[model samples]
Target: METLTNDKATLEVQLSTQQKLIANMREELGICKEHKAMAESQSESRGAHLLELKAQLEDAVLSLEAAERRMHDGELMRRRLHNTIQELKGNIRVFCRVRPMSSLEQVGADPDIQPALDFPPSDDLLSAGIILSAPSRDGAATLSKHVFAFDRVFTPEASQDAVFEEISELVQSALDGHKVCIFAYGQTGSGKTFTMLGSEEQPGMIPRSMRQIFESSQGLRQQGWELSLQASMLEIYNEEYKDLLSSKKLSGSNKSTKEGFGSQQPSGEIKKHQVVHNPDGSTTVSELTVVDITQASQVDLLLAQAMEKRSVGCTALNEQSSRSHMVFTLRLEGVNEAKGKRVSGVLNLIDLAGSERVKDSGAAGLRMKEAQAINTSLSALGDVIVALGNKQPHIPFRNSKLTYLLQPCLGGDAKTLMFVNVAPNIQFAGESLCSLRFAAKVNACEINHRKKG
Candidate 1:
């Protein structure tokens, strides 16, 4: 009986101890669950913060990209503005172009006779400064060399595309509301025509310029500009303006008409229109044909028609030679809706008659008269260029009709470029030198811009 009671007491003590241990284990489990919940809550908070930070970082990157683009655009705008200002200052640029030797000129040449012309070394392989060789009177083999510098020079090897690249910026200036004049001054058969009006395979300045203007207009439409272009073609023969796009003229390569003897009248009773210099410093002729040009093809057609009407006569130098100066003018007028401003720009592309000596040209009769007129006008032009270079108080703009009409171009607000073409034939060295000297004088003339509207 005593042993059974002791065993029951021991069992009771063991049960109490086991209960205490169970209570302690439950408390510890509760604390661990609480800590786990708190840890999960903190992890959720950190995940949300990371998402916010990621979004902020992405926004910052986008902002940086936008800023970079804006900065780039600003830089471009700055360059454009700088160019516009330079052009507005009436900086007359000059470029010289040398035609390659023709097969005819190279048919029979002295093997011992060296080339009279040399070009200086230049960074641009396409262009080089001109160096002319003059034979000394002593008859020594050593030739006198004359070197001339120009704004740019194009060798015979230069492509039309390459030549256009140098002047494309000038075309852009015309679109930017500045008057731009580009004329070729050279002897006959010096590739002036080829450079100005290249063939279908290789278009020259007029075609290239027209194409660029039209294309640029399309792009500028986005900038709130509505542009309208008008064109007119005319010939200055015997100091008279003959409408090239006139309906009265027939289309042929060689047509000679005896012009009437008068200051402005030719053989035909073509109306002698009076050229009025506008108060705004622009030239306008009475009874002139101005055609609206909408597309590049229209320009092509107008040019073709003008060429057909141009007075060309066969000469010893050139079979299809320009007897009269042909001037093709483009007037660009635009309205900028954003700025509420009106912009007017004039682009004059001139192909002057070849400056040839009457004796060398083998001209007689009407051809002689034409040659005399060409020489007279060109002399007057040279005089005008000289006066401009000297900054003479009195420029003889009224000395000849050619000078009168080109007053705006010669020494005024117009941005003018004279392309002096030279034939590489050693036989024509004298005439080529004359042309270069004239170009050098013209290059030295500084023109100032008038206030633009």
Candidate 2:
């Protein structure tokens, strides 16, 4: 009986051990399945993200290809559009602004650009709604804004309060129906962009201008006047233009410029995209962005996009040089509060490319070619000024990429203001003179305002 009892106990212990082994296997299997599911989910998510990145890359490539086409074939398109451009001439007003002078030694070798002869110094600037500078404790930080109207021809280092406030008035004038053009022109290292569109850390004329527009619009509205606004943002890179406001997938194969003037290219570093003009006298510029905003944030959003997609390239003078021209145009179509009639106006904020000597640029191969193209375009711009000054029957506006692209603004019915930026360096004196001379000529360009018949 004792032996039988022992056998039964042994059998029971073996069965119990077998059951424990099965349970362990089941738990292990479950864990493996759960882990496998999680791994698969992660893999799928990664795959989607990769696909999105691929799409973005493809779009960028297409834009690049389109840019290449414009650089090579732009001349052809320009010839085709030449007739249409001549047929329609918009109002363009040129205001030449010379940055106040700063000493080369004190400014650590910057440039000083002179304003044109249009402004003559007078003690009674208050009549122009201008404020002259009173000495401040902060030395010469900068004109916080273009607040003063000076025929005095001060350097950029003179008065911040005067500079910004004057520019603000210029902005107000544009919104008030005078075609306005404001620009920054100077040497390669001059503060051309700084005076017009300051660094990311600092906001220059454009921001200041926008603030004034909003404020002006607000004031107008408070007086029971309403306005409709349209904004277009674009950038010219390597002679090829691109729309900074586009969220769509744009590839060279599927992209095109306005009026079929630009088609896709196979390859290139900088591409040209055509400016898309809105029907309300505002042009969206490219597939990039064309928004009509009654609010300030919308404008800021557009500016952010344009700044992001600016033509930045590696350079010796500026770590990231603006590879092309950047233009932000705002069209304000509003009712005349006093007249109770419809009015139209356009304000173009142009940041022209700084002039860089090819040899000094220190670029190689492709970069060298790019620099050459930029220099050539700028030279042609100079040629245009010379022609306009000569009052020649044929102003070679189509001589270079910059001039051709600027036909609408420079030659159009737009009030134009130019802020010639300077670096205040002795070495840049020659370039400064060149810039001042150009501003003087631009100031002389004729503005034909459309007369209501």
Candidate 3:
């Protein structure tokens, strides 16, 4: 019995041990399953992360390719536009430059003295036109608002560089062996001089143009081009031509004689020259001084000398008024060694005498005559421009000395650009309107064919 009891105890003890072992195994199995489940979740998360990374990389690559394609398309478009502009002949383009108020004009003068020029909003792309409202008289309703449109309208705040950028293409046309003419026209004190021949610090169209031509010629040399540049300066005072570069002097004082056909007799030989027409429709003045220029600084000096010799006088309209029309001609001759081709181009830079009203100019003696001559020439220029705009069969080219001299630019295949400078002052509104109207007429004229050499 004792053995049987001990055997039972041993059996019970073994069974208890076995049951504890099974419970331990169950807990271990649960821990293994939980760890396996956790491992599978981590693997799935990593797999998804890798797929997302791959998608992002592919997207980045596609975006890069798209940007490259856009850049290529932009480059191609730019080249096409450049070629088109080069092939197309530019018409007579008119640009309006509005002069800022002078120090005198801005001083504690009456507010009414300010111009009625209405500038467009800053963000407006189509704001290149100007609205000139008639002055308010006795606080009455304004008479009219003259809206003038131009190819370009430069505000008073426009920089000299900005103005030149618009016309630099025309300068390039001359370098490409096309005749180019640029002239500034306006009333006295309307900033024609400032636009054409700005101050030393500013340096206007004439100086900038010479530098551009010089730089461009250097680049062309790489293409086997040999360039020759010649410049001549002349002024028409009272309808006569005076060589500003001539060494001959007037008989009396340092003041040169008023040169023109129907003007007062010069004390000495006025260095007279005759205008001859070539069979090819080119015109040249006999014995015109043409200086070969290698550097732009030489042009600066030449312009300075001409300005010193220009007829300027104080008038009620302008304190330092230019009393005559000045024309500076740059002749460019280019030879390409590789092509064995030669090209000659003419660039005419003109600063027209401001048209002044006799009553406003308060002229006496010689100034009165100057006013008459200037008005007459400007009137004739108007008639020629009007006739040209009207597409008249016989455009009046022999109306006045100014028009006659500009016949090639006005009537021929030359590319012409005119800068209509307008004063932004109430006192000069009428004159500005007239000047703008004349420019509008010029802009309307169309030249069918342009000679590219």
lDDT of 1 at 305: 88
- For candidate 3, lDDT tens digit of each residue in 208-234? 999899998876785567998878788
Model 1 misplaced regions, further than 4 Å: 1-90, 109-111, 122-128, 134-143, 249-269, 448-453
lDDT for 46 (candidate 1): 89
Give the Cα lDDT of each candidate: 0.77, 0.58, 0.77
lDDT-based ranking: 1, 3, 2
Ranking by TM-score: 1, 3, 2
Best by TM-score: 1
> Candidate 1, residues 1-453: lDDT per residue as tens digits?
889989999988998998898888889889989999998998898899999999999999999778756764674596478566655543677799998888867777777888867888877532347897866659786777778877788888989999999888778877877777788889988888888888899998999999999999986686557998888778998778787876664222212221101122233544565676767766767656667788998988888989988999987777887999988888888887645668777788889999888777788898888888988988888788767756789999898887787677566545777899998777777678878887877666655532211
**Candidate 1 positional error at 160, Å:** 0.6
Residue-level lDDT for 210 in candidate 3: 92
Model 2 CA lDDT for position 119: 30
Q: Relative to the unseen true structure, what is the C-alpha lDDT of residue 93 in candidate 2, on a scale of 0 to 100?
A: 24
Report the Cα lDDT for candidate 3.
0.77
